[model samples]
Target: MVDTGSANRRDDRTPVLAVAGIGKSYAEGKQRRTVLADIGFEVARGECVALVGQSGSGKSTLLNLLAGIDKPDTGDVEIMGRSIAAMGEPELTLLRREHIGFIYQFFNLIPTLTVAENLALPLELNRIPSAVRRQRIGDWLAKVGLDGREGAFPDELSGGEQQRVAIARAIIHEPALVLADEPTGNLDGRTGNVVLQLLAHLFRDQGRTLILVTHSRAVSEVADRILALDNGRLTHDTEALSW
Candidate 1:
């Protein structure tokens, strides 16, 4: 059985995210299909939480809810102490740009933008000065082992290299939260393992809160807590984890 003992440790600080009683549904052929039901969880600052389940188990639905890409029919979602459920699209956009970062399974890098430009996009959107953005791009690219490839476009890089660019883009702005959806799903096992270890280490060292949705056991092993989703509900909130 999944343990709830750590749920009591939430008083550690204000959670980076607080999800309460969230539910989502869609209509199909005049029938309402529920995708998630009464889902609730809290991710504290600097914590890495993993959501694992079979395909069609609503893992992506939960990630969408957390990212504000979709809204729940019931319940509220608070991010960085702000209520996302009540925000209009414009406000939500601003909040996301300013405080949240996303890493996608497909690397989501703009094919037309060069590597350095891609990494600088977030900071540019935040209106940071060009000099600062340039410096950050240079430093992060080197850290990701892609130094001197700044002028290359996404199409010019291999899958692993593209993913490394995605990672650099996600954290360059130093957002308070990072949401990764099957981050390594596109790489071979060995390459995926290397990227996963890099991501886990970087997020921890930066003290960024992470909520990762993944099916890989290797990915799940890096989380500080593991929660399992079944059907439309959370079936497990495993015991506290360290490392």
Candidate 2:
């Protein structure tokens, strides 16, 4: 028999994210290569989980799958008990817009938009009322320590500041799950720690589920659980991990 990865515990409350028997493959010439196989795990509501591994471990691919940016070749990804495979691109886009917040390594901010406008873009796309959007933008900007820099364009901000803006834009809508792919990869140790702490603390205070991908041991230590992504699969999961 083959091992089916691992799990922590099944809390009575519904999981914010669940992946069962997930597998992915791609064609290499005339043959197929498996990227991930038999991946399974559950992240409880309000839990912060880290997916850690070396490069080429398929960690980012898994993030894309979970965020509904790509489809799995097998098994299912359920966010809030809804199967992501059952939705189309439009629906998946809306789902992400409404419930998922994504942060990237390079801080993908719109260069043409000021910090304030960029932060307000998602709210406007979601059709949040103008008054409410304004308030949320102001609130999150301050929360992320970007209040005074709101009028600065992305190109005008420093690396750390740009990342803060990215984070502010992500959580402005109070997403249920925040998927961060190497959110601090571009920062130096000091700045990286600050960004990591801000992300972790925000999730903790809001009771939101967070799936963060990082290779930094210090970063993973902050999570409620540490999940290993190996050979494109979730091979191990440990709760309340301490170095």
Candidate 3:
């Protein structure tokens, strides 16, 4: 049976992510606005966790903190066992480049880049050789069901197609952690379902840790654990971890 309550470590592996005493706030003119306060959790390696909450529930804020895109006002975030708070900007950038992948709510594909070019981007940024990049692009295109549309521009493709490209691009380099923010929010029901399945299958097959911020029940259904945030704190966590 699967261990949803704690890290499913094979031996002595560490958790993929650990958020401790996390608190984040913003200034709305004069007073401070607390977006997330004293929130904490750990995501195990190879586990898929769904973060769900009503709109304006600090979900995105928490995700940004996890990705090191935003700093916590009080507390620390650790990814792959490294402290996000301790890293300088250059170090953080390298950490993100080497270990993280992201899928945005709106498919953030560069309009000028073709499907193949977009998928080839992460590999290119990591300085993968041209020949190996080409091979991976071809493979990922087929994996995401866009095999023959490699040269097509973003505008030429449908919403679902663009998202497929996004998914393919995000995982092409096999980052240890993948952060998806409302990945299927813009697609129709059927199309969204297809994309979600692709995400789960590919992540599971590759043994990557996935933390998805979503409101869809269908998305949460696939996760090993479901966490809910309210106002600026974690109000509910199903399957609490023992460690």
Candidate 4:
């Protein structure tokens, strides 16, 4: 793996992510519609935060901003103490490649690539040595309980298995932060619970910080803290309030 050096120098007391006075809106012909208003939060190292919101409550938008996938109209988003809005496109791309990992609801594995290849993509991008990459691929496959399925394609696996591969892929590169969007939404209830349990265990064991966007109360309950969004506003939810 490429030695970014930043992680080693980071203080554990510093938050992995910080967002301040963030706001976003979209132009709708002659008018603009606000999606998020004055949104703000901090996620410390190894903390898992769940973002719960209604369909249009802007949970995805907030996540996009945090990932630097999209920019907010106002305020700032900082990851590892660097402002995302201050980075150029190339810098943002590099930031994402080196610092952020993403998990999607649909198990966004490449249909054409084998499981090993899929897991190796991030390591390859980060210029990890081929030997180490192979070892990590084997190791993560075992961690996610997908051993011996290295040559299998995405379509060949069950939903839970595919998601397990996705989870391993997201984390194998050892990113500082992980963004999960409805990670278990595509699976059956029993399978989803099992996957969730595995995800929580692996992340906690590795001490990786996570911000998950989920609609299910059961899913959100796994997080250390839950933040609720409604009508473009955010609130800390101790009760894990339902929409």
Q: List the candidate 2 regions with Cα displacement exceeding 4 Å.
A: 1-12
lDDT of 2 at 86: 89
Q: Local error of candidate 4 at 164, Å?
A: 0.3
Q: Which structure is stronger by lDDT: 2 or 4? A: 4
The alpha-carbon lDDT assigned to residue 152 of candidate 1 equals: 99
C-alpha lDDT values of all predictions: 0.91, 0.87, 0.89, 0.92
Candidate 3: where are CA atoms >4 Å away? 1-12, 239-243
Per-residue lDDT for 1-243 in model 1, tens only? 655666545544779999999999999989999999999998889999999999999999999899899999999999977889989999999989989999999999999899988888899899999999989999898888998999999999999999999998998999989999999999999999999999999988899999899998889999999989999899998743542
Q: Which ten residues in a row have the lowest lDDT in candidate 1?
A: 3-12
In model 2, the clashing pairs are: none
Candidate 2 lDDT over residue span 1-243, tens digit each: 543342223333668899999888889999998888888899888999989988988887888889988888999999888899989989999999999998889999999999989999889888999999888888888788877777899999889989999988888888889999889999999999998888888878888888989999888988999999777777678874553
Q: Of the candidates numbered 3 and 4, which has the greater lDDT value?
A: 4
Instruction: Please give the TM-score that candidate 2 achieves against the real structure.
Output: 0.92
Candidate with best TM-score: 4
lDDT agreement of model 1 with the native:
0.91
RMSD for all candidates, in order, please: 6.1, 6.5, 5.2, 3.9
lDDT of 1 at 126: 99
Candidate 4 on 1-243: residue-level lDDT in tens?
A: 855576565566688999999999999999999999999888999988899988999999999999998999999999988888889999999999998999999988999999999999999999999999999999999999988999999999999999999999999999999999999999999999999999999999999999999999899988888999998899665533432
